[model samples]
Target: MKLSEVISIVDGALITANADLDMDISSACGADLMSDVLTHARSGAVLLTGLTNPQVVRTAEMAEIVAIVFVRGKRPPLETILLAEEKGIPLVTTKSTMFKACGCLFQAGMNSCDV
Candidate 1:
């Protein structure tokens, strides 16, 4: 699915400038634990999480995640945003809970990375 489609599916707002909204995301993984993300996430996947810290961006970078969706209306700090921008990762935010955000994406034909 495209990043634009994911944003529409979860009713999210893109917070990053110069993001390629047309980028295709092949999989997704929702986790608050950076360890779990590193363990299970796939390259070019979208990470949905409630954690809003620089570590999240760093973990996404290491895991090759294409984008991040901060759930429950959470917003990352400026430092985190800057890091993500530098890494060329798109950042989105939604009011949905982690489960709902994941479900929304899944229902829209986005498979879990583990699948």
Candidate 2:
């Protein structure tokens, strides 16, 4: 689904990017642990997390994840945004809790980021 559709699905706000709405996502993974993200996440997936640190950006970069949806109204620090900006990753925020956000996405036909 398009990023715009995802935002609409979860009532998310575009934080760092006016990303292209045509972006297609095949899967998703929600986690606060960067290690799990590193080990489990795959390409063309959106990451959902409450963590707001630069490490999140780094993990996304390494995992080649280009989009992030922050759960529970969490927002990353400016430093994290700076890194994400440099990496060209999209960041979005939502008021919904992690569970609800993931569920909404899943119901919308988004799959797990893990293989």
Candidate 3:
């Protein structure tokens, strides 16, 4: 799936200054634990998480996550946003909960990062 499609499916808005909206996403993973993300998320997957910490951005960078979707309409602090922007990782936010957003993407044919 494409990042644009994920945005449309979850009613998400890009929070980053610039991002490749056309980036191809290999899969999706919804997790709050950064360790879980590091362990299970595949490269090119979009991470659906509620964590708005700068550490989330760092974790994404380490895991090679293509993008991040902050659920429940939560917005990260400016520091987090800046880190994401600096790292060239796109950040998105949605009013939907993590479960709903993940379900929406799954229903739309996006595969899970789970093996």
Top-TM-score structure, candidate number = 3
Q: Which stretches of candidate 3 lie over 4 Å from their true place?
A: none
Per-residue lDDT of candidate 3, residues 5-82 (tens digit): 999999999989879889999999999999999999999999999999999999999999989999999999999999
Winner on TM-score between 2 and 3 is: 3
Worst 10 residues of 1 by lDDT: 106-115
lDDT for model 1: 0.94
What is the descending lDDT order? 3, 1, 2
Model 2 spans with C-alpha error above 4 angstroms = none
Model 1: CA > 4 A from native: none
**Which ranking of candidates, highest TM-score first?**
3, 1, 2
> Candidate 1, residues 19-90: lDDT per residue as tens digits?
998999999999999999999899999999999999999999999999999999998899999999999999
lDDT (0 to 1) per candidate? 0.94, 0.88, 0.95
Report the CA-based lDDT of candidate 3 relative to the real structure. Answer: 0.95
Lowest lDDT 10-residue stretch of candidate 2: 17-26
Give per-model TM-scores: 0.97, 0.94, 0.98
* Best lDDT among the predictions, by candidate number: 3
Q: In candidate 2, what are the lDDT values of residues 1-115, reduced to their tens digit?
A: 8888888999999888556777877789999999999998988788999999999999999998879999999888999988888888889999999999999999998887756
